[model samples]
Target: MIDLHLIGIGTGNPDHLTRAAIAAMNAADLILLPRKGDAKSDLIDLRRTICADVLTGATRVVEFDLPERDTSAPYLGAVEQWHDAIAAVWRGKIAQHLPDGGRLALLVWGDPSLYDSTLRIADRLRADGLAMTVTVEPGVTSLQALTAAHAIPLNMVGAPVLITTGRRLRAGGWPAGVDTIAVMLDGDCAFQTLDAPGIEISWGAYLGMAHQALVAGALAEVAIEIIEARASLRERHGWIMDIYLLRRAVPVA
Candidate 1:
């Protein structure tokens, strides 16, 4: 049996690693780091840095290429095929490295329970009939890091906070009943779709990392600024992962 540990390493910052996550890394027999080409080489480099700082066990480190999703297919179908391909890669790597079966670990970005697919991929391994045990070590999430970096509370007192994706915000518009919404996986800046009447936005890119950038103000006031900044940064860096929080102005009683 292969004991698989999925550890969340937080958003690219070495300091964001938790004590539990550190200990888990030190205990693993093998750690798998995924390479997503040169555009995202920084991600793998961060994982290596974490391993260098915390790994104490005789754990061997392995690198594997991440499969790119075929965007020509429909979104859900493409994602499904992508997950299967990734599972196959994982199986091959594990079998090749641990012919006798042993413990393995993967460093995940942000909390695995959040918008990440590490757990879903792990589940795919189970469906493929791989006899392996899986465990998760939760770490700080991008949402938490964004909020902390801005020194703002996620929601108003006695209020609900909606966690959603950029696609949902773009397609369905602002959700009702909740003034606060945290959006992820939004490459399109879905906030631009809003009417921008009483909405305020707090946006962060590369939260908790060295090149972090944050901007906040009335949606109408700073929307263009964010767009320009995001474009410039993406061009300079070749890729970006960002999240933002939006709030509608609450009326006074």
Candidate 2:
């Protein structure tokens, strides 16, 4: 049986790793790092850095090319197929590296419980008849990093917070009842699609990383600035991962 450790490394910050996560890394026999092409090579590099710092065990670090998803197909279908392909790649790597089945580790960005799909892919491995035991080491999520960077609470004292994707924000506009919204996985500036009336936004890109950028102000005041800044940053760095929080100002009764 393979002991699979899904370790959360936390939004690119090595310092964000918990003691438990570090211990798990040091205990793994093999650790697999996925390279998502030249545009996102920094992600692989970050994994390497973390391993170098925390992994004291005689763990073999292997790097594999991550398969690109087919965007031409329908969205949900395409993602499902992509996940299958990733699982196949993973299976091959594990079988080749640990034919006898041993402990393995994968460094996940942010918390796996958040928007990441590492857990789902792990489930696929189990479904394929792989004898594996999965363990999750939770780390600081992007929401925590974003909120900390902005020095703002995620929700009002007694109000609920709605966490969603940029696509949902675009398709449904502002969700009712929930005054605070945290948007992730947004390739486009979905905030531009909403009416900026009484809305405030706190946006952060490459959170917890060295090249972090943050912008906060009334939506009407900083929406264009954030767009131009994000575009320029993406062009300069070749890739970008960003999250933003939006809150509607409570009307003075």
Candidate 3:
């Protein structure tokens, strides 16, 4: 049986790695890292750096070519096919590296439970009738990183926080009953669609990395500024992973 460990390395910062994560990596027989391309090479590099810094044993490190998701197809359909293709790659890697059942580890960005599909891909292996065990070691999420970087609480006292994406926020605006919203995977900066007055925004790009950038102010005032900064940052870095928190102004009692 293959013992697969999905360890969350936390937003590309080695410093964010937990003791349990380090222990899991060291205990694994093989660690798999996927290369996403030049623009996103920093991601794989961060995993490598983490391995180099913490892995102190004969644990083998393997690099794999990541299959790009075909976006031409419908969103759900494309994601399904992409997950299947990734499962095939995982199968090949496992068979080639460990003909006999052995422990393997994959470093996931942020937390696997949040927005990431690594667990889903792992589940595909089970559907394919492969006998393997999956275990998750959670790490810091981008939501936590963004909030901590800004030194702000995730929500107001006794209030709720809605965690969503740029697409939903744009398509459905902000949800009711919650003044605080955390958005991820928002390449389009959906906050611009909000014409709501007195909305406050705390936006951060490349959170927890060396080139991290943060901007906060009233949404109406800094919406344009955020757009310009995001564009400039993406142009310079070639890729950007950003998240933002939105809060509607509440009147004083």
Candidate 4:
């Protein structure tokens, strides 16, 4: 049986790795790294750096080319297809590298339970009859990084906080009954779709990394600034992962 460990590495910063994460990496017999093409080479490089920093044994490392998801297809269907392809790749890699059973690990970006699909993909492996047990090591999420960077609390006094994606915020607008919202995977800066008034935003890009950037202000004032900055950063780095928190001003009783 292959013991699969999905270890969260936390926003590409080696310093953010937890003790459990380090132990799992060292205990693994093989670690698989996924390369998402030239544009995102830096992401894979970060994983490699984490491994180099923590690994202290004869653990083997392997890199595989990740299959690209089709953007033109319907989002759900496309994601399902992509996950299947990825699971196939993982199956092949594990079979090739570990014909007999062994321990394997994947360094997940941020915490896997948040917005990541690694667990779902691992489920696919189990469905395929792969004899493997899974273990998870939690690490800091981008949400935590964003809040810590801005020195702000995630929620207001006794208030609820909604964590969502850029697509949902754009499609549904601000969720009712919640003053705070944390948005992720927002390539389009979906905050622009909101009414903007009475909303404060704390935005951070490349959080916990060397090239981190932060911006905060009334949404009306900084919306355009954020759009421009995001575009410029993506142009310079060829990719960017950012998260932002928005809080609508609560009226005085």
Candidate 5:
């Protein structure tokens, strides 16, 4: 049987790796790295850097070109098809390199339990009748990095926090009865669409990596600044990953 390990390496920082993540990487017989494209080659390079930093054994490392999702298709349908394609690629690579069934690992950015789909994709492998077992090693998440970078508590003194995506935020507006919201996977800067009056924001991009950017202030005052900075960073790097937190002003008791 093949033992598959989905190891979270955190946000592209070698130091973010946990002791358990390091041990898991060194123990694997094979590690699969997926290349998104030249524009995002830095992602794969970061993975390599992490491996170089922690691996101390004779584990084989392989790189494969990842399948691109068809943005033209419906979102859910496109994702399902893309996951199938990825599973096919994984099957080919595993059969070619480790036909005898051994421990294999895929380094995931951020915690897999978070907004990441590595876990969902892994489930596809099992559904396809691959005789494999799965294990996870959690690591630092972008949410943690964002909060730490801002030096703010996630929730205000026992207040509730809503973790959501950009699309939902744009579609549903600011959720009622919640003081805090953390947003991820927003390409359109959906916060711009909100009618927030007394809201404040703390935003971070490339958290835990060099060249990280941070901005915080009243949402009305700094919304434009954030949009400009995010655009410039994406233009310079060809890709960007960012997260933001919003809190409505709390009236004094």
Candidate 6:
């Protein structure tokens, strides 16, 4: 049985690598890194830098082409197909490199359990009759980076926080029971669709990196500011990974 490790490397920050994640990387017989093409080559470079900085052993580092989901298909369906393709790639790599079961590691952008499909793809291998054991080394998430960049608490005192995607927020609007919302995977400023007048937004782009940009103010006031910031950052960097926090501004008594 192959022992697999999914190590999370937080938001492109080399310092965000936990001791356990470093240990996992050094311990692996093979480490797989994915390339997402030229537009976002920085992501690929970041993973390479992390590997160079951390691996002390002879762990073989391998690079793989990440499969892009077909946009024409429905979102969920495309994602499912994409995961299957990624799993196929993984199976090929393991078979070619380690025909005999051994320790393997893959660096995930963030904690695999949160909004990542690495674990889900790993399951496909098991279903395909490959004997394997999986372990996860959690790392800092974008949500953490977002809050840290903004210097704000993730949640208000004793209040719930709804962590969701741009699509859901655009479709559902502000959910009930929680004034605090952490929006992730939001390509479009979904908050623009909200009727939230008294809401406040703290937005960050390229978080945890040198070119980090942040904008914060009342939602109605800075909504366009964030939109423009996001567009400009994407153009400058060729890619942007951003997240934002929203809450109803507390009225002074």
Using lDDT, give the best candidate's number: 4
RMSD of 3: 1.0
lDDT by residue (tens digit), candidate 6, 1-253: 8999999898888999999999999999999999999998999999999999998989999999999999899999999999999999999999999999899999998789888889999999999999999999999998898888888999988779998999999999888888899888988788989986889899988778899899998999999888998898899899999889999866555
Model 4, span 84-164: residue lDDT tens: 999999999999999998999999999999999999999999998999899999989999999999999999988999999
Clashing pairs for model 6 are none
Off by over 4 Å in 3: none
For model 5, residues 1-253, the per-residue Cα lDDT tens digits are 7899999988998999989989999999999999999999899999999888888999999999999999999998998999889989999999999999999999999999999888888888889898999999998999999999999989999899999999999999999999899999999999999876899999999999998999999999999999999999999999999999999988989
Q: What is the C-alpha lDDT profile of model 1 across 1-253, one tens digit per residue?
A: 8899999999999898889899888888899999999998887888999999888769899999999999899998999999999999999998899878888999999999998888899899888888889999998999999999999999999999999999999999989889999999999999989999899999999898889999999999999999999999999888898999999999888
> Any runs in candidate 2 off by more than 4 Å, and if so which?
none
Residue 223, model 5: Cα distance from true site in angstroms = 0.4
Residue 190 of model 4, lDDT score:
90
Best by TM-score, which number? 4
What TM-score fits each model? 0.98, 0.98, 0.98, 0.99, 0.98, 0.97
| Candidate 5 off by > 4 Å | none
Minimal lDDT window, size 10, model 5: 116-125
The digit string of per-residue lDDT tens for model 2 on 1-253 reads: 9999999989999999999999998889999999999998888888989988887769999999998999898888989999999999999999899999999999999999999999999999999899999999999999999999999999987889999999889999999988899999999899999999899999999999999999999999999999999999999988999999999988665
Candidate 6's C-alpha runs over 4 A off are: 250-253
Q: Output the lDDT of residue 207, model 3.
A: 87
Off by over 4 Å in 4: none
* lDDT per residue as tens, model 3, 127-187: 8898989999999999999999999999998889999999899999879999999999898
What's the CA error at residue 48 for candidate 2, in Å? 1.0
Supply the global lDDT for candidate 4: 0.95
Q: What TM-score number comes out for model 3?
A: 0.98
Higher lDDT: candidate 5 or 6? Answer: 5
Q: Which wins on TM-score, candidate 4 or candidate 5?
A: 4
The TM-score obtained by model 4 is 0.99
lDDT of 1 at 207: 91
